[model samples]
Target: MSQTRFRARTRIVFSLLALSVMAAPAAAQTIVSTYTPLDLENCRHTAGKAEEDSGVWRCAGFGGIPVHVTANDMRMYVSYGGNAKNEPAARETLASFHGEGTSIEWRSERAANGKLKPFATILRFRTSVADGDKTVPGQVLVVTRLAPGPVCRVGYVDGRANPDANALARKIADERARNFRCGTDKAVVEGATGPGFSPPAE
Candidate 1:
């Protein structure tokens, strides 16, 4: 074959290879989840009085990240980044009676380098619902954002109303938690909500 023809064919083959490399889809990010038990009984009391007690507890999180759990007035608040002071202001639901569960679910994104960066948390809360002459028990899954600022509740799924509350909460955390803007983005509430289950004002 002529040298001119061979060189021209080689350039065309290289161009095609470059185009295929550029057109290939990027790898999808993997999501990982880990759970830690919250033992308030073992936590160190920080402040408050009697029934209005407050305290902070440290729990293990994904990738050796420190998880801080703060309890105040029967409500639970959480923060990440190893600093309890990074905890956002209390933004509880309008419920009159509510308390958090003993476990926390951390949802993180796994990077190409095998690093797990937490982006959201799923915590269970038991609330009361007034039904006629008696009060009934109700459960809610609170999805909290972990980064881009102080941790804050980003979404909620009423367990009594949604049978797949856990899946829904995880979905919300994966989709909305990363970019949730504290005090600006209003938390989303799904399924049947009681009079006291209203989301706090942004």
Candidate 2:
């Protein structure tokens, strides 16, 4: 009964996930990208010698598109397995990300409420296609709410920035929530292709 109830509520929440992607600025970005869903259920990516977790997910490596994107995963194994002991430790370890540009960038921003929640810790890595430029531009933000497993809920903003920087950030955040697919459906950005390319997912 509890499992059923959990499934029901989760379904309701994610129903908004797909719609959010479409309800964005009329003149905003046109995603010209293609992707394949990475199934983390295989367990091969999660296994290791120690309790620590490590894995990687490649989205565009299959040559479906010129844009290649990959994410390398990381987790810390607690020598002591208790919440209280780890809360402070997590806080200390998840410090402010003080870098920017190239592949990855970290920033400090005041979130909702006067208090801060470490804003965003962006990590990005990708292998570009032969037709693609190595200096491709993209941005990402992820919140890995570690339950029994690392069930990560990620948000990202792609493409280059325009003159208005603040507008760019807000547009990215809006697109992030819109592009979010909470359950099994992998979130996709349609029309992210180069030249006359268009994603079938769109």
Candidate 3:
């Protein structure tokens, strides 16, 4: 080939390669899972009004975040942050007539500063399914987002219906938690839902 023709071809090839490199997708961020135990039995309780019949507990959360759990009537509500500004409203409740488990699974990502930033949490709630005249045990996994205004529930998985409830919960957290909008966005419920497995009225 002629010298000029070869030089022109080489320039075009290099330009194409450079453009391709620029258009390539960046590496995805790494996400991780860490666990923190919730001990309602051991946490300090804060007294509320008699009519409310509420018991509140402040528990240790991953990465210095504070977990606030409140039990009112027969239902439980959870919030996370450093103070009241980052917590959910007093009327917020994740489930109806359900009790929560003692363990909390925190889904976080490592920041550039080598700190863990928690984005979501997974907690199990015990519900009841009516059978005959008695009630049988049922479980629901609640996935809650940690930020974007007063951490709120992002999704729920029916443990009895989904064999991989934990995996689904984590998937929901990783996919939806960071961008989930509290109050405005509705929490998603996956798998078969009935009676105690259904989403809360709130």
Candidate 4:
């Protein structure tokens, strides 16, 4: 190859490399962080406080939200429920909480762990209590395994200074449900919903 041509090609390569380097920070920023059982435990008010009951793992306060995880037969079954249409069943699986708020809608219905099984839904909304009271104005995240119905609902009972944790709860549920590979003897969905769940689509 001609020296001039080689030099031109080298310049193009250098430009591409520079672009990639420049783009690195943006890509890193977009990267979501995942959580583990330990991390969830750490979210408690006192930290390292978690309890297991009937195959469900309950955390006092995950990112300021009362969180619970269940990987039972029901959960594993629903996690793999067919397509978006199964979302209704997934919704039903959740035991009703205090009261429904005005904003109720779908958050996401997708494969857990980026696979075809273990589908889950991460829902966001507020409670029906009056807005002025101290106990009012909290958010609820109902993450249900639509395929098999392992619902991990989180409630942010009190307000917090850092609102980012409110969003992180959903991501935690997403990763937990995606990794929901439960079995008879062993039922547990494991993974961190790195960073936080994406804001609901406008």
Candidate 5:
């Protein structure tokens, strides 16, 4: 190749490298931060209407995905990571899930260790495609904890937080919401809605 052409190509390559380096920091900030960390803070005091408690801990949909809270003095909800559609699917799968748990499996793949907390259990679990899905991506690692009774759940959600972990977290949050049912204990957790929760301040 011509020396001049080679020089120009080298310049382009160096420019791209520089741009990539610059972009990495910003990308990391947003993607590597907490999952709805804001919710964790706000759930300290925020009231949602009669929340449609989805599942798990049952908080009446008071907490969004990956939300940490001592909401209504009920269980804190935290999602593994991911968008809304992620959780419902997992619930369905788990409901009829004759196979192994996708999230637990993925987490185990990258797990170097695990720890337990009060109402919170942190373990290395898969958050991505299952073992048989060859077309899917690699395994994911997720660590999470759930605190029962008017506690705040706070944690970092790496950009690549596991899909299963994300979905499962949502499932847990939904359950927690229902449990917080302000008026009745039929489907309630300690600090949640039943008689325990007081609608948080706006």
Candidate 6:
């Protein structure tokens, strides 16, 4: 082959290879199974009339700490209530439900990488247990994701426990938030393509 012709052929081959690479599908991310805390042993799941489109399971025998997971599979509960509007509206709706003394700590309606994301709220507060005037620190995380439909949200609340117990509860909540699968969802932001609830470090 002529040198110029050979160089042209090489360029064509490299171009094809580049195109093929670009056309290849990205590798799928491995999602681990749901995390079950050791504390929840022989706990009875709450049973009651469930909505045709949604379901909830509350597991509570874990040493006085209750863990609940709710799944919404349809468009019935997609909106954050009120006018069924956007993220700000949703945040307003959520804010209405805060306990009398609860304070809003942080929120991320927009994903980290600057994209319009589903509403997510993180709150911290102190709660007092019954019997006496003993109070303990607590954190509640609520995240809403738009996909597959109903915009599944995982609400986790933990309080009135020892340091180790608090750690375990936080871990369970973090894992639950992490491994949840909603639908063919894209990263609301550039970085977090999935649920971005990173439980606060103990």
The clash count for each model shown is: 0, 8, 0, 19, 42, 1
Q: Extract clashing residue pairs from model 3.
A: none
Q: RMSD to native for every prediction?
A: 5.6, 19.9, 4.9, 15.3, 17.8, 17.0
What TM-score does structure 4 among the candidates reach?
Answer: 0.36
User: Using Cα atoms with residue i matched to residue i, what is each candidate's TM-score against the true structure?
Assistant: 0.72, 0.27, 0.77, 0.36, 0.22, 0.26
Which wins on TM-score, candidate 2 or candidate 4?
4
Residues 1-202 of candidate 4: C-alpha lDDT, one tens digit per residue: 9999999999999999999999998655432323323232333232222342124333432122233333332221111222322333222332212322222222344243542222343434333333344333334444444334433232221212235643554555455555554332222222322222121111
lDDT of each: 0.72, 0.29, 0.78, 0.35, 0.29, 0.32
Residue 54 displacement in candidate 4 (angstroms) = 27
**lDDT by residue for model 6 over 85-187, one digit each (tens)?**
3322122212111221222221223334544322232233222222235433233333343322333344433332233433433343334434445433321
What TM value does model 3 have? 0.77
Better of 1 and 4 by lDDT: 1
The number of the candidate with the highest TM-score is: 3
Residue range with the least summed lDDT across 10 consecutive positions in model 1: 193-202
Which candidate number would show the highest lDDT if scored against the true structure? 3
Model 2 regions lying over 4 Å from their true place: 1-113, 118-126, 132-181, 190-192, 195-202
User: Where in model 4 is the C-alpha error above 4 Å?
Assistant: 1-3, 18-97, 104-118, 125-137, 148-162, 181-202
Stronger candidate by lDDT (3 vs 5): 3
- Candidate 5: worst 10 consecutive residues by lDDT? 92-101
Which regions of candidate 3 fall more than 4 Å away from where they truly are? Answer: 1-29, 84-86, 130-132, 194-196
Which portions of model 6 show Cα errors greater than 4 Å?
A: 1-113, 131-148, 151-153, 157-202
TM-score of 5: 0.22
Q: Rank the candidates by TM-score, best first.
A: 3, 1, 4, 2, 6, 5
Tens digits of per-residue lDDT, candidate 5, 81-189, equal 3332232222211111011111221111111232211232222222223244342222222223232332222222221333344555433333343233222322211
